[model samples]
Target: MEDDPDWGEMVSRHIGPHQKLRLHQVASVPEWAATADLSRYDLIFIDDSKTSELREQTIRHVLARVAPETVVVIHDFEIPPYQNAVPADFERIAFSSFRPMTGVVWRGARWTMPITQLAERIDARKHMSPLRHSAWRRYLASGTGPAR
Candidate 1:
């Protein structure tokens, strides 16, 4: 999910062309937290950019709403402040020094599939991109499904 329209649009242009992506942009984190069906997502990226004034609150809301089995990729997790904000149960499932990002597993699961293969499946099946809305009702009603 992304809050910035410009970034969201860019993402649509890029990721949308190569892979299916349902981009959700919400005016407020609370609205998304209250309305989004977190169970639908297998992979979720929570952008913790420095400029998003709502960073901390947004992360908290995402964590609260995200399903236990979902994989959460927290952007900029290397940052001291952001690292401190993550919940204890979220195990660091993937991280690379070449990338300043981190992937977290919310719950333990018995899986034999390689992580890379699972990621590919999740990306291919992405749907439900909800654009930011001014009201809770609108937010609940928003989101674009992956193109057929």
Candidate 2:
């Protein structure tokens, strides 16, 4: 999800896209979350919030709606109270991004083969290149599967 249309395009270019994917250029993600049927998506990427509090709220809203197998990728995951906001029952894995940091969170039996494979392919050391040298980038670019 993204609030700004231009940046949202850049984000879409960065992550590639899923046929089942849904993008919401919403004004208030929390408000949108309040009514959105978020359960249908297999993978979700959130670089939407503009502040720390909104970020936490966005995550909580997503967590409340998504299924256990849904892949929730959050940008700037290592930030202060943002990290604190994540509950103990969920599992999060950090990786590189344009922010120089990103993380994917999930609950339940999250060790699904695709999820585990994505984690292994991601470069923990560098941001993705639009040129497609990154395995993780290529993996998504190919539309091989959802991050789940």
Winner by lDDT: 2
In order, candidate lDDTs are 0.59, 0.70
Cα TM-score per model: 0.61, 0.69
lDDT string, candidate 2, 1-148, tens digits: 5667888787688768777665658787766765789877888877676677787888777877887778888878778666666678888776643554777778877455566666655544234453555655556666554232
The candidate that achieves the highest TM-score relative to the unseen native structure: 2
lDDT: worst 10-residue window of model 2: 123-132
Estimate the overall C-alpha local distance difference test score of candidate 2. Answer: 0.70
Quote the lDDT for 146 in model 1. 34
lDDT of 1 by residue, 96-146 (tens): 333555655465653324555444433444342323223323423343333
